[model samples]
Target: MEIMLTPAAKAGLDEWESNGNKKVIQRIHDLVESVQRTPFKGIGKPEPLK
Candidate 1:
């Protein structure tokens, strides 16, 4: 599956690889973790009829 990411976000990921920026990696990982931990209860898209 292909995914699209913001330019800044992509750069953070790349920096983690090339420069091994541990802080940046940790910050990004924390952000993703918080998102996953939070419950998304707002309006969501329903499966389209096929």
Candidate 2:
């Protein structure tokens, strides 16, 4: 599967990497891949706001 990020998100990720926090970037990528593999199927629709 191909993962494409928005321009803004790409910038944010680039900034994050530049900050010397590759772990967070790696975590984000890992989570994205995991979700793509097994996405969350909600039980039902959201309730109406009060």
Name the runs in model 2 displaced over 4 angstroms.
41-50
Worst ten in a row by lDDT for model 2: 40-49
TM-score, every prediction = 0.45, 0.60
lDDT of 1 by residue, 1-50 (tens): 23458999788688786887778777767656554555342123324458
lDDT, candidate 2, 1-50, per-residue tens:
56789999899888988898878888877777775765553222324458
Q: Which clashing pairs does model 1 show?
A: none
| Cα misplacement distance, residue 2 of candidate 2 (Å) | 4.0
TM-score of 2: 0.60
Backbone N/Cα/C clashes per model: 0, 0
lDDT (CA) per prediction:
0.62, 0.71
RMSD of each: 8.2, 5.8
- In model 1, the Cα lDDT at residue 9 comes to 76
